[model samples]
Target: MLTTNRLRQQLAQKQTVFGLIASVPAPIMIEVIAYAGFDFVIIDMEHVMINPETVEHMIRVAEQSGITPLVRIAEINAKEILRVLDSGAMGIVIPQVEHKEQVEAVIQAAKYFPIGQRSMNSGRPGIFGRDDLADYMERANHEIMIIPMIETVQGVEQIDEILSVEGIDMILEGAADLSQSYGVPWQTEHTLVRQALDHIQQVATSRQIPYCAIPRQINQYEHWQNKGVHAFVLGDERGIAFRALQSKLAQFPVINTDRSQTEL
Candidate 1:
């Protein structure tokens, strides 16, 4: 049966919901993030090279674990979007959306008839073809989300137009890419980058659609919270795993080995 999009629910209620990028390419990791209490998880396809079957299993695991699963699609094309959605992703994050037309194209590719020209097919998301096609199409159109990424200066500048296109449920700030695009190169908090992000946030806020962002520095979270940002992607799985190991590694005493006749 179709269910409510919890991330959308959280955003609609203006609640601050937290999530992470599931980049580990393991269904267990997806389950673990949900068990860890994240409200949603983005199964990252743009960076990770997990095969199609694995992606479906991860989505199924997410459903089993009770986490809203969204996909960061490799590109803004019909085939990729449709396949991911058919695989049971509740939403999608399209990167480098620089113009209103791109956003419209994504909307066209994601939603069904009367809203978009997406090809019709039944899959896990449609309850494996058990649900009536008409009902599924109606619910799917209303439930699925198309979130555009604003990563470049051009995208930020076209923010108003992009958000103006209907069916875009949220906008994500690609901080790392935005920083690089602005020539700050890894300095996400650089003044210029901050200005662009602030403008994007301002536009989203005014439009009443949720704006999402990921914070690299743990301390930087409060700034978004203070700005009333309601949605957050809490960094990628590998980084989270690495930082966890790094923290644990810091706690143990260092091991030293020396081999010498006198020492022995």
Candidate 2:
């Protein structure tokens, strides 16, 4: 059901917020993430195969666990945007946004009337028609976030125009894809990628828009913190889990298995 956007409220108050990308499609994983103290979870539909039903289940778990749920769609498809928001996601994160018109179209699909032409329905976001329609529309427009990711070089070039879009609530930087776009595939910390990211951050900051950074390196958290960034998406949950499991195994010594030594 639609509710106040605590993540947006935290950003408004200049509070630092931390989140993780949920590539693992399980609602139980989302519950664990929320319980683990993440401020938000980007239920990924871009790089994963989660269906609409699973996404909604994850959102429900997030709500129950007191964490914000945002959906990261692959592109600017209206149907995808509408479905996720209707499923009760507090925000939509569109990736590879390279133009102002793209952002405009997203707003059209994500926002209600007078803001955009988002098709109306008394779905879960409207409290299943229990809440007054007009009040729900007003609250949805005010609370639901329209976040665009600036990943490509073209996106970085058009940052100003994209940010100029009235409905954009926040901007997320995509260093991994930006690195690929810069011809340094997977080199998220390459000099060129770093320069582009810094430029995006500077522009977003100058325009008074909150910039969300994904720290790929050890010192990057402090780096963005010193620059006054309030939002961060730590790497995806899968990678974090893999590393933790690897570390746990590394704590034990391997058993010797030489047959010759055992032949007494």
Give the number of the best model, judged by lDDT: 2
Give the root-mean-square deviation of each candidate in angstroms.
Answer: 1.6, 1.1
TM-score of each: 0.95, 0.97
Cα lDDT tens digits, model 2, 95-213, are 89999999899889999999998899999889889979999999999999988998899998898888888877889999998998999999988999989989889988888889999
Model 2 misplaced regions, further than 4 Å: none
Across 103-203, the per-residue lDDT of candidate 1 in tens digits comes to 88888988899999989987777877887989999998988988999999899888999899988899999989989999989998899998999899999
Specify the poorest-scoring 10-residue window by lDDT in model 2. Answer: 160-169
In model 1, the runs with Cα more than 4 Å from the true position are 255-264
| Candidate 1 residue pairs that clash | none
Backbone clash pairs for candidate 2 read none
Reference-based lDDT, residue 134, model 2: 94
